[model samples]
Target chain A: MKKFMNDPETFIEDSLKGFALAHADICDVTLNPSVVTRKSLRREKVGLVSGGGSGHEPMHSGFVGKGMLDAACPGQIFTSPTPDQMMEAARLVDTGAGVLFIVKNYSGDRMNFEMAAEMSENKVAMVVVDDDVAVEDSTHTTGRRGVAGTVIVEKLVGSLAESGANLEACVAFAERITGSIASMGVAFSSCTVPAAGRPTFQLADDEMEFGVGIHGEPGRRREKIAPTDEIVAMLLDSICEELKPSSGSEVLLLVNGLGSTPLSELYLVMNSASKWLNRREVAVARSLVGDYTTALEMAGISLTLCKLDEEMKIHWDAPVHTAALRW
Target chain B: MKKFMNDPETFIEDSLKGFALAHADICDVTLNPSVVTRKSLRREKVGLVSGGGSGHEPMHSGFVGKGMLDAACPGQIFTSPTPDQMMEAARLVDTGAGVLFIVKNYSGDRMNFEMAAEMSENKVAMVVVDDDVAVEDSTHTTGRRGVAGTVIVEKLVGSLAESGANLEACVAFAERITGSIASMGVAFSSCTVPAAGRPTFQLADDEMEFGVGIHGEPGRRREKIAPTDEIVAMLLDSICEELKPSSGSEVLLLVNGLGSTPLSELYLVMNSASKWLNRREVAVARSLVGDYTTALEMAGISLTLCKLDEEMKIHWDAPVHTAALRW
Candidate 1:
């Protein structure tokens, strides 16, 4: 495969090593069970931890720092992390206020994080995010798959936790974010796992996958490639349909690039979504555009709309210091 | 060409519209002769302006904000922006303290920026960046081509300008940065300009273009893909040879992605480079990694090294708030 890595077996380890070294001021990497923890833990504050498969980077790991995730456990590419990884991460970042696990809605992730929370000696709470509105079930998930909206949930809840919220309050805010956000993705091409050494799926030059998952899982349907406006409308339609915000409601719109999509394209998608929302009299209160969550070298874009309240807006604007995100 | 664009002719405009919308808090986009200028100009500070072909995104435009560029002019994809665009940007951002034009060493860009400076009424100084050590002359340039190092020049010089340096001092610091930094890129696959509807060039499955330019210009040679360590060594060797940094010298290292390469891969490259630099006893005082400057969707990585002084280190740590970068 045409990837910048040494061995498929050691891909995650190698990347984690680099990640820790690059952001040495923010976080540290612990090998054996594989966990990324904040360099400095805030005393008596809720510890926020998140994790999942490896390929969708800057997601769990890059989010580990002040005002975001306190620890992250990464699994093999497109594979869920073991329960031990999560427990170890909890052990590292658990202040007296306890640890709150932000688990995405995937069967493996849900099961493993639950086990980790149960096994932890420290007070622990879990908030499962199932924000993707693409489908009811998918290859790795039993219900709606958590997608780009996970980033939004992480940011808002992390901010709340950093503000010295208790574990119970952090979990409530995390759940509130999960309920308010909706995401859907479209792929022009599929990404390959390094070990697999080939694309997970294929699309004709003129075909596109709608509502695709982060792991190249099947979406709602496959259709001919459409213009930017039409594709954006389709994704946003799905999101707005699920969330059903009133005409005067406000939202934080996120245009996320899946690995290989250009920032220009992601912004174009954002423009289209904003225009679409404006027509319905929905206000875009805040916006984020770039590659926050990705599926390896997949060429795709995901649109997330989070119905925002004053609390969400305030915390979203709060300071954050992380590798992939900061303000 | 599986790109998420409406029409090739309107790609840049659409993207810019979205960019202006998403970052309305930081910058404004002017359409006719496109220019992205800071939302609030810091009056009397030397205005830092940079521009180039559109594809290397988050470069000229995304860098326009506080503690960075005051303005950026974006041309059509892979083509130099017009003199009018540059002149308009200078007109918009110049606040009595004169404008400093940071031009990459591309023939077309140099000519257009020079013409813009000459025609404009505002006092202007230019620093042409030719940081690439790949070749003495290349397709788009007479001297070495400026690649990722332009970001370094803009960051350092931009910081100096933001710190209220005089136009002359800013120009001197820009020149110092232009001379101290060196960069080289390698491409695993070619990128397609939307209008072209085809890849810039083709490569066999196992081959890679070493010392490639940001525009997919021919590099030193095509060779079979090598291990990550070997590739990192070759790139760092060329940079060190040209820069000839002493063993104890401290430098800022930037591992930049060429649009489509994954962040994991970029961080892996950083890990390898850090190891290589440590072996030589050269200190990596500061590190920046990710897709800062990118060719639309080229799958490659570029390494940039800037020998650092205490002054540069202090300014490098200065706060910058831009779409693609912040601290």
Candidate 2:
């Protein structure tokens, strides 16, 4: 696999400089040998910060604006951002109103963000988003994992913070959204990291992996390419059983395209999902279909659903602004 | 090339459903087929609608919501949205305040959106963004093409619209930003469409394509990989020449990663760009780096710069809320 770069080693530093320059209204940078934090100031509003691997653009950093993260820590590629970086962001965004760390369920992310929270001087609230229903349903998995569903929790909670809701309110709102959401992903072919210069995993052309991790880690099962309906059924069955929302509950359905999957294929998956849910009489009040949280250019898609209440709907309606996510 | 979908044909449709379900606050779908429209009801606001091929997520559709597009017409993967679909969106969002079409500078996109605009109500206004410096610099091209820079124009213009600027004012602002911006892109490998199940084009292991189109089409030049500084120099030379900003003019730089390029690599390119610009005494007011407009995870990046006037900076800072972007 060929890739584009002058020198692979200098990629991160160059990208950060460009990010800071383009988003000067919202993001600033502090660079030393040690840490990188996007300016996390929301004035007198309570701040929110999140960080992890750098590959997921529009996540930690792209979200550093109003109605979202006050600051973001950039890690090296898919590796977790350093605790020191998160701590710096925590310090920068803490306006005495406090700061909330929106961490994914990944072990590395949890431990690092938690450490940063502990080291923070101002009040630090922690919310871990473990919304991947796929991991919990896998008979062999040790614990539930976080995936694209983490984005929803961040948005709901971020809006609360942007509106000057207290830190405790933001944390509770984040946790609540986390519990109500679930996600599952599959990959057709592994993405080749520019630095790695090859696909992350090997799969036959006719085979696809289900329950795959975003970073290209091995998933629970690898199987032949199934029909769209079959694939959607399997993914939904796992997610539905995990969340077990009642029939009358309003659900926000997400048919997320993994990095390389085309929107056409994603829409087909959504068709299947809508049909299946309709058959079950599940009321989907609203739906989002796009590449919200991506896994490089992996050719796959994930399904995320947030069972909604009145409050969740209101929260969802609130305005939001970030580089990649706007509403 | 391995891909994730069970069937390549279904990728776009499946992805759209998920996208619609993922973020419901700013977007909703029309059932007969699939068209995403904004939920924010600003009755007197000029509705902006954008759409094209499906591969460039967070582009036409992801940008639908308040402070940006009022609706997004999604077409099949890599194909322009149908004129009929565009007409439908044009009709739905036009609430007497008239409608504006923000189209990219692609032959298919230009023709389709133009046809749609003509077919729709005469009150609709249309603007085509042609801002890619690479396409313009190549005399062989028909006209300067639009790429990621179109997004900046959309955001800046959209914010102006949301701030209650009239259609003429918004269109004028968009035109100015478009005039001030320049972009160039390079790719290492061709992206494989899921249905095609192969690379879009072939690349030798050490080769890179410079001045490539957004769909991984062949670039203006194919050469062996070089150092990061040299690469940055090449891109900056093109952009700097195209945008002859007055001495001491402020700039907003965007270094965008094509799908699979790592953020680390993007940052490296940004750093090189900054040093190069600083040596020339260009004032960098803002910088944005990440995967804004992607080509199905192609391992490459593009650089876009907007010469900022005070008004442009204010417009850029105006709040926006869209499904895939919020600021």
Candidate 3:
């Protein structure tokens, strides 16, 4: 509950100033309003811009560097960035090649990024990643949702663009990754945003909610504590059924820690995933076990798997340089 | 806190499986125990290996890819990888050029990595990074500690080695970056590792601690909550004085969240950091704002700064490919 800030209002602005000051090699900040973009002046490649509420570091902004996003419009903590900011980023990052907006499948993010993409003069391609496999849509809402799978789309499309692929190619690549990737998360405890000064949601000492969202959104089902293997099986079963990649198709597994799960726990979940997949004889080509994308200090882990072909593999291996992710 | 694991002992292995599956293109997992390595075989370049407990994801394993770590040894959750695992990793990653072990400044990590380095007959060099500015020698039971600053060392040295720097030169470069870098963190709450199933430490709602280590290790002092500026001031006063980089010296700043802190809170703190450094006229060459190194959803941010010269900047900008960090 303790936070360091002069005022909640100035938090985003001040943080952007410091972030801009430090990452001059790869990023620059826009004035008057506020936005982040790669330092490259040409903007010759198909510009890819992404943004959302600010709490997720490295996601919207940390991805702005070579082989990734051309720009990112960062918003207030857990709040959507203004549409105007996204438009400015679109203008700044657009090369003659055009621009693309990668968005998580959240109501606020979808609405904002989509609005910006439509309003901007630059030829814009918009892709919303909705790969969370945790939720089963009710008649009132969309099935599943976007969570950590957003990062996979960014990586896939960013690398394609960096390799001189055009906007169309980038869009196609983004779609492919989005289709293949699936994520499911569970939360042991709710995270309290500093300004909010309280837990987002309440959980008992011995309970956990399966399939939680990043913003502490409600998930499909709540369950009691279970063995890591059972949890992994539940998550993987949901994702595999959703993705349904052809048998023997290679897959990339991501065991993501919600904010609070320790790496050890993540590892335990991943071990279950490996055994489960091996038993099925599924070829897991690569594995990423860590906190790639996180839910604020929620003690849980999400499993994301992206089915891959040779092209995706090449894209995944391409060199990249960003503050949060570098490979 | 509820956790997802069949047994405490199986966490690391499962997680590595998920990790390997998620990044199949860039990494390969060995089943006969567990070790992850880059797919690109480099026979002539000196291989770099680092590993420790699983809780700190992307630290040792997530970093294994091009232009960074070549291989990572997996240990049980919150436990150091055995010397045998490290040796296996060293041997697997080594090319004719030699191998370098980048060990964080922790007793277990140092001892394990050192033993691996010594056990291997292949020419190997080792560099231990102890850049946490918070751990004053006076209070430490043993020696200086490593915190978030290890990321900078890993990236810089990884780039150098990838570019074919010799073992000694790589060690020297890592040493140089480690010497120039300093980091300090503050935590509002203690994190609960899943297996442990309890708070690492307890804090009153109104209390906070400065100089916290990443593993929920207690800092030197605890104090009542102060204004953001005052809190940041206390941190800077300790870290800046400890670093004491000359005025006008170029510095790279990293404002890192400890897992749970939202971007809004981090930004607020960074505003204070920017104003403080500007008041001192310290030249900031660059900065990185995000969760580069985190303590399993601890609700806080750490500030890291490194005095930078032309060489450091060159390496800083170099391309890298890894699971957690890319570019």
Candidate 4:
């Protein structure tokens, strides 16, 4: 493999070690190197926690800072963290205000986070997100899986928690925000796990994989590669159909790159998505375009649209200080 | 090639259209679409004008905000902007204070920017950056070509300009700071020019290129891919040997990813680079890790080290607002 790694089996541990060392100002590690906690915390505010597999950098770990995830427990690449990791992270962040876990909608994650909440002595709650309207079921997931909207959920709800919201209020906001969001992705090529040393899936040089999951799993369909506008139309059409926003309604838009896609391409996607929304008379309240939730070295882009209300808009505009998704 | 693009001939223009729409709050295109100027400007300060080829998003264009470049003139993909484009940008940003053109050391860019300075009426000075100690000459450049250190130049000098430095003062600091910087890069694959319809160069799956230029030009040598530490050793050693910072020196380190490289790998690069500097007893005053200067869709990383002084540190810590490289 041409990857910049020491060993396939030890990639996650080494990555986290380096991550903690590099971002010491904003984060620190606990007894378990896999669990990252914010360097500073508010005693009277609800504690926020989020995590998933290791390949998606800046997802859970990079988001652990002042205005985002309070603690993150990362697993191996494309694998869910164990309940023990979550339990330890829960204990680290549990002040008198209580703790909330932002869990994605995959079976392993769903089961393990549930186990952690049940097994922990602290009062724990989770808001499971399933905004990917791509497929109802997938290889590693049960119903519609969580995708890029997880970034939005963390950004919006994390800000609310920082505002000294109670645990119940944070949980309710997470659920409400996730319910109004829809995400879909397309991949030009698949990614390889460091241990596997080969791609998880393959696409011909001229073909594309539409509605791709974050783990390089099979999507809704594969099709011949098309122009930028047509490809954007297909993804936005699917999202717009599900969202059904009225002419005067406003929403927040996210155009995220899946690992290896260029920023230029992501900007193009935003440009196209904005034009489409304008033509449909749907006002876009705020827009974020960058690589937030990514598959390791996967070449693709994902789009997430969150139908917004006034509360979410104000929370979204609040100052967020994190390694990623900073304003 | 599997890229999200339409009409290769018009890709640059189309991409800029989208970029302007996406960042309308901070930037806009001048009458000449190739010139992107900050929406708000300080007329009394020296106007910083930077331009080069397109494809490297968030570099020239993304840096055009309150404390960075006053205007950025982007050429077609991997091609230098014409004298006319630079002249237009120079005219747009020029107030009572003169304009400073930060040019990378490519032949086309050097020639075109020189012509633009001569052909314009505004008081203009050009500072050429050749910090890439990779080779004395390359495909499109003369002397040591400019690489990621251009980002450092733009950031530090631009902030200085915002503090009301005159044209001569900005030019002197730009040259002094650029002189202390050194950079080197490695690429696993060559980037394709959209109009060319193929990668600029070829590499076997297990082989890698060291000292590769930002535009897919040949480097000092090609070798079989090795472990991350060994690869980093070669890059850092080469940079250290040329710049030669002493044991008690302070420096700002940058680990920049070529486009298409994952952030995880970039972080590892920073981790490795940091450790190497520590072993050498070199104190890193500041560090930045991400894709700042990129060959479109190339997989590799570059290492840049700038010997920092007290003035540079203070300017670096000053509040600067831009699309990329914000604190």
Candidate 5:
């Protein structure tokens, strides 16, 4: 697979060791339950938990720390963590306040997290994020699949939870924020699954996939690779087609890499996206561009736009400290 | 090239625009001089400036913020910036405490920064970083290439400068820190240069290059693709072979990707490197793992180790806010 891993079977677990060790002071990892919780939980704060399959680093697990997630329950590659894992995380991180689970919109993730919420002793609120405007449904998902906007939801809601917001308040904020965002991705090549030991899909030397899913699912359409300006305009047009922010409306822009796309390409895409927005008269108030959400070293970029209001802007700018996404 | 860009000739400038706009809250970007400096400079703090080719995002520019570099001058892809860029940066950033130029160990970078220092009005200390233990000399470089160790030098020296270290003091610490660091890299594939419109090098599907340079320069040797454990072992052994830390010495480990290498692979490399260190009884006091320094779309990881002492540890842990790194 051309990946730096000893064995495909052990990659996820061994990667967790690196994740835990990298942020040893901030997180305490439990292997059997497969949960990573904050080292010191707040005594009276609503606990925050987010999890998904592996491969998307700096998303769920890399984000467990102060002013962000209280715990992250990681599943295997692109697979949902079990109900037991989420229950264990809730039990470990819950204080006198309740617990909130940030689940993405995929069917497996929603099913597992819902059961985990009902099984937990503490009061729990589950907020499902479904912000990808790529499609209304996908091959691996029932509804619109949650994409890069999950990172925004976690940052905004985690900031509120850290500030002593109740479970309902965090859930409301998560829903509002999730509703305010949209994402669309462009892929230059398909990714390789470590276990599968082959490329997930094939592309010619001059082809690109538009609206590709994060898990290497087939995108909405394929076409000959175009110039950067054209590629960016198409992605932004798809996102804005759903979100439909009017002229002069303030927004937060997130240009994320699918995986193998380097920062140069990411920034170039951001540049074109910015030009795209500027021509439309939209005011970009805040921007977060990087490879926060990925598809296992796939060559692509996803453009996520978060329509921000005054209150949302405050929460978005709040301080956060994690293994990744620190500010 | 499969990169996202409107045009190869305009990619660097447009990408810089993305960079400036991304961190608009923190930086002031000038087009003619191609300088990116802090919006607000601290008077009496020694100014730190580092710059090189534009493709190395977050290295010279993503690092221009509080507690890191005061200004950065980005050249075209894989080319050294001119002296005028550095001179303009020094002119704007210097607040009467002079400036420190952190130049990588490339002939073009050294020559250009030296010329800029001679021409600038402000007192300057130029510290050259040559910690790549790959080979004594090779194409595109003389002596060892600076590689990823420049990030360490900037972080340490930049922190010291922010604390108001004088020019001489910054230079002394820079030399000491530079002497105590070593780096080595491994590449699975060569990157494509947009300007060149072709791949920099070629490799068989089953071959891997060890002791590679950042700019896709040839490595010391190429070997058959091996298991991840053996790959990490080779990289760590090369780095340790040069630095030769005592058994109990502590270090700050930096596992950097040469762009396109996903975080999944970066952490896997870190996982194996950490295991390698434990077997040798070395202490990892601090770890920074991500794509800090990168060649554009080069699929590889570079390991940098800075043997830390009491003072260096304190400075390393000190808070610094930048586009790529914030705490």
Candidate 6:
């Protein structure tokens, strides 16, 4: 595995060290429990917190800042963070308004965040996001696995929280987003975990994995590589089937790169997705194209579609300041 | 080649179409002679224009928005844009105030921008950036080749232009930035061009290309892969040799991913770079870590350091609202 790392055990810590320094203006890193919290705390505002495996960068950690996540707990690689980490993050970010935990639908993540919420002293609520329509069950998840659409949940729900929503309101909006969004991914190549020191899976040069999970989990099937439009159609078809937006409905389309995919290719995917939606008479009111949630160095792309209402659109357009995401 | 592209001939146009759509709020795309221009032009402000090949994304095109390049022309992958594209872009952005062209130090790019400036009707000035300290001369350049440092030049100079600096002042500030920054890169694997249908260069599984260029140009040497610290040391040594920064000097450190490298690994590199700079008593006043300029889907990282002065820091801290960069 050709990776720029020293020790696999220290990979997350080292990367976090750099991350803290690089974005010191916006967030601070607490080492023991590995919690990243916003530099300034807003009093009486719902504290939005989310986290998962470390491989999906710019997710929970990079999303910590004004108008986004209040804090984030990072686990090791594809492993879930301990309950203590989540508890610490909640404590750091929670003001008088209480805290909300945005947990992805992974067995490990769900369990850990649940434990944290149960033991927390502050009023805390949890919203499990299972936006991935690729599969009902996966290697690390029991139900549909949360994938790239978690970014949409974090951004929209975080915006609502930033607008002084209470903890219950934040939880309600997060659940609404989780139900409205769908995502599916395709992998051109598998990623190498630092500990594994080899690719998670192997594929011939002409093959591609469809509906793959974020951590290289098995997808629906494998087939010979197809044209860009066909590949995009496969992912979008699954997503659209789940969402099933009616004609004249507006939505936010996200073409997210699962590490190693170039921005140009992500844009290409976005272009094809826009065409597909237009043909179906679905208006794409908002679009995000780039690597927001990545799986190590995997070469793939994920398409996320969130059926948008006026409330969601207002929140989605709100200003956000974070490390990997800022506007 | 496993790329998300329909046809190699239309790769650039298709990607630009998606980019324009994705960032419609910030910029617009003009075809025929493709140019990405800011959505709202600033009348009487010196126009900043930059362009080159298409593969290095977010460089010339993604940088086109408020407080950055007023316009950018994107050519075919790894091919210089034609003079007409530059001329057209200059005409579109030059509102009363003269236009300033920021050209990277490449034979074709320099020649084309020069021709465009000579044939233009509006007042024009050009600043050629050659910040690469990898080698004095290379395959695509006459002197030192420009690399990731071009982003620094564009950001700092673009901020100056946005602050009502005239064409001559912008040119002077760009030159000052061009002279102060140094960059170098290394590639673990070569990227395939969509048109070529194969990798541009091959490396043994355990080997790496040191000092590689954005277009897969040969660097100083190739050797077996080294540890992250050693690699950071080597690249930093070359860059520091060129700059000879004093111990107490402050600099903006940028750890840029070529294309396919993960953000975690890039942060790991930044961690190592910070250590190296710290050992030398150099203060990192500003930091940027991620893919700013890329070479298609190449797996590599580059380090760029620009010595920062009080004025430069003020401009660098100014607001910028571009597709790839915003604050």
Which candidate ranks first by DockQ, i.e. highest? 1
* Whole-model lDDT, model 1: 0.91
TM-score of each: 0.99, 0.80, 0.82, 0.98, 0.98, 0.99
lDDT of 5 by residue, A128-245 (tens): 9898888888977998999899999999998899888888888889989998999988899988888998998898999998889999887788989999899888888888988999
**DockQ ranking, best first:** 1, 6, 5, 4, 3, 2
Q: What is candidate 4's lDDT per residue for A1-327, written digit by digit as tens?
A: 678887777667666766766678889876454799999888977889988887887788889988888999999889999999999888889887889999989999999999999999989999999999889999988899998899889989999999899999999999999889999999999998888899999899888899999999888899999988888889989998998988988989898899888887788777788888889898888988888889988999999999999999998888887877566
lDDT of 4 by residue, B149-203 (tens): 9999998998899999999999999999998999999999888888888989999
Model 5: docking quality category = medium
Clashes of each: 0, 72, 46, 0, 0, 0
List ranges where model 4 is wrong by over 4 Å: A31-33
Task: Grade the docking of candidate 1.
Answer: high
Q: What DockQ number belongs to candidate 5?
A: 0.73
Q: How accurate locally, in lDDT, is each candidate?
A: 0.91, 0.75, 0.77, 0.87, 0.88, 0.92
List each candidate's DockQ score. Answer: 0.83, 0.37, 0.46, 0.67, 0.73, 0.81
- Index of the highest-lDDT prediction: 6
Model 2 docking category:
acceptable
Looking at candidate 4 chain B, the ten consecutive residues that score lowest on lDDT are: B25-34
Q: Give the range where candidate 2 chain A is weakest over 10 consecutive residues by summed lDDT.
A: A32-41
